[model samples]
Target: MTSSQVFLSIALPFAIIPLVLFTSSKKIMGEFKIKTWVKWLAWIATVILVALNIYLILQTVGILK
Candidate 1:
């Protein structure tokens, strides 16, 4: 993987985590709760991150090109 991919792999999730927490937090989800759309988007993003992490590890180990 190139430097940019490596940077994104680390940065993207690091970036999204705070938003996820904020959106799902008790303070925000208490009264006017998180919308279905937001939840689905978060879930999809999380899945993508998991897949990317797996791919990056495999590439690091010479299992992927």
Candidate 2:
């Protein structure tokens, strides 16, 4: 895979998943935990990123156009 694709599929998820989980975890962030709206937004973004990564994988595998 290309370097950019590798970064997006692997590195980006590694960074984003922890960021979303940590920011949303009250136990981790305490009073500084992300607000509800921001948490939802982050979750939505994470979902979109995951979807895009799946699409990229499919494309790389010739399952997608």
Q: Which whole-number lDDT from 0 to 100 does residue 30 have in model 2?
A: 99
Please give the lDDT score for candidate 2.
0.87
Give the runs in model 1 whose Cα sits over 4 Å from its true position: 28-33
In order of listing, the candidates' clash counts read: 0, 0
Candidate 1 lDDT over residue span 1-65, tens digit each: 58787777767777777777778766866865677788788878887887888689678768999
- What's the residue-level lDDT of 40 in candidate 2? 92
Tens digits of lDDT, candidate 2, 1-65: 78687566966788898999998899999999999999999989998998898888888878999
Query: Which candidate number maximizes lDDT?
Result: 2
Where is model 2 more than 4 Å wrong at Cα?
A: 1-4
- Candidate 1 structure, TM-score to reference: 0.58
